[model samples]
Target: MKKRLLALCATFFVAFSVPAFAQGTVISIEPGDGVQEALQEALILAEPGSVIELAAGRYDFTGPLSLDIANITVRGAGMNETVLSFTNQTTGSEGLLITAGGARIESLAVEDTPGDGIKAKGVDTVTFKDVRVEWTRGPHAENGAYGLYPVESKNVLIDGCVVKGASDAGIYVGQSQQIIVRNSRAELNVAGIEIENSYFADVYDNVATHNTGGILVFDLPNLPQMGGHSVKVFRNTVVANDTPNFAPPGNVVATVPMGTGIMIMANREVEVFENDLSDNASTNILLVAYPRDYNDPTYNPLPRAVYVHDNKHGRAGFAPDKAVKDIIAPITGLPVPQVVWDGAVDGFWSAFFGPDAEDAIYIREPMGTTFANLQMVKDMILPWGASPDFDIDDYDGSVPSREPVSLPQDQ
Candidate 1:
């Protein structure tokens, strides 16, 4: 698949001059004019290609602003110039929603929304430029849905944006193809950025931090279609974002890479390289096996065929338990020690592949063990920079009572 364009190219200049529709309409929403009135008027007068300009201030809408029009432009003075504050939107409403083709939103701020900050659905040729989507009301699982959500769409571009404080995810793309999300910041949300059930998508040069999991590429089961294939996650900074486990009791499974910085699950032929992921409470880099059957019904395990390479690990807090224990063989003729972690060499071509018994070293049929650069891998292995207490019975953190931690749903 051809890679989606990451940067705004000069080619757009050619397309920008195409004659616009609704030639006589110049709708302006300013501090003096009520935002609701401007929006109502824009809806009344807006044609296929109308431009509604907004001036700077905190403009609160009484309810959701649903744009069913096609090929319209809703722009603000500048990113910082005009602010549409939705702190008072008490209904479960989105700050801005577009349900059209060739729609564009630029230089605006949408925040404190009861639902997703900006939702664009079924829109082809949509572009969000220099926009900010945030949920500053505080991180509650019920509050933040998504900073920016593009679902079941095609030819979407989300660039130069900021998404934060989302209870669920900063930016979420689901059931979409030919998408591009670049030069964005996703932090302090449930899952920073998630791309699920998407094909031929490119997520590059983005910062994902201070969330439960940083970046996720996965395919969900039982969807109308099976997608999430051939994606690339590269050139991003994923850092210490593991707060307390928020996944509700009996709903989450504790894995070593539990609060992993980046997880590539159930996707085929994916490349993860050249990113700095560290200081997370769990494993810095993880290649997981799809959970077959687990205690949590909320998440389905589906990881397979991943290529993890070229990343750095950081400092450790404590020593994990390491003992050369016994193993048990499976009845289905599968070796017990399936997933292998080899930190002695580079991650790309390392010999410690999973589920093959010929690669076994000493202990045969071990139940499940974690090996890292820690001296314990041979004794009681822990990866470099990971605390021994990780995934163990004893775990503590900056905040402990956060519950119902759900990973960012990519689809």
Candidate 2:
């Protein structure tokens, strides 16, 4: 991938008429005392197709640093050796912001920011490898909302990274396309990893623990984008995400229950398989509605065509909290099934066209893994004393696999 990125930049100059962006030129910044000034100067003077390398050291800054030049690579000696702390950041809401295409940021650490650690918006072919974004004060309400936030971007790849101590989500990808987030670790956040309102995503080979919710795939209303679908989440270790929800009020993630292994809400065609989810106090896997009133005509609040299969579940669904305790536990009892569905749907039509609608959450887990469909919609209907049909067989089918995301080589 490195060679491919390099070759793409090399071919860009030859294909175009830009010559000032010379090849074989590297800009090195070793700021000993004047860290902010050196970085600001480097960012302003950097040309396209150039590499901005920072030497191994600790640097403190008071504002955000952003790059707008295309085909730029910002690298450091190592994640631990080269640290950038934004404890006193006062200007921008993000520690490092990128608005350029074909940008590669690698091997660095960003700590203690007021807002987001690294926020890249509306960029294409942006990659973050071996990067660490953390809040050293540890999970406080004043901590950054997100460690790594990429929104409205295309061909995004985040690999081999560690993010922690976020008030909202450790790693959040929102309203993006063709995304891949793998081989990463997220801990001590409201949500470990959240893929929201996105399409064509593959999230796998990641570790999510010690947070409010291990992983979340949510689709909410009132966004630039709506009706996100076709995401694959598999082959991950999610356990012991029992952190308190410290997010500020009105944020979507603030409602996430502590000790949730994984929650899938208001999305379609999401396949979750081959994950090890255990030791979560609340629930192993949860499928529910959007849990709000919305008027968006395009936003579908029901989760449809979801396939959950072949996962290893251990010691989950014991201790409940918040809504799970007040509404779900009394219906399903403690140690709530291995998989719990809120049984929320789109009114009377759901039952009238029940098995044929294919609007279902499918599960094929191993034996001894309990399952429950809470039949939440029946509360408004008459004769609700008897349980509505919670048959697992009614919601059984296979969803097609989504195509793997592949970034454009030419950017």
**Per-residue alpha-carbon lDDT of candidate 2 for residues 56-110, written as tens digits (9 for 90 to 100):** 8888899899988888888888888788999988989999999998888889999
Q: Give the Cα-based TM-score of candidate 1 against the true structure.
A: 0.68
Whole-model Cα lDDT of every candidate shown, in order: 0.57, 0.83
Over the stretch 1-411, how does candidate 1's per-residue lDDT look in tens digits? 111211111112122333454353445556543556556557555766766667677777756777777777778877777777777776646877878877778888887787778888877767787888876755565564778888887777888888877766678888887777889888777778888777767777898877767787766666653547656677788877664434333322112232456766555545565677666555444444353354544443434334444444452111111111111111101211121222222232332332222221221111222223221122223343332212211111111111221211112
TM-score of each: 0.68, 0.91
Clashing pairs in 2: none
Candidate 2 residue-wise lDDT at 236: 92
Which segments of model 1 are wrong by more than 4 Å? Answer: 1-26, 245-259, 289-301, 316-411
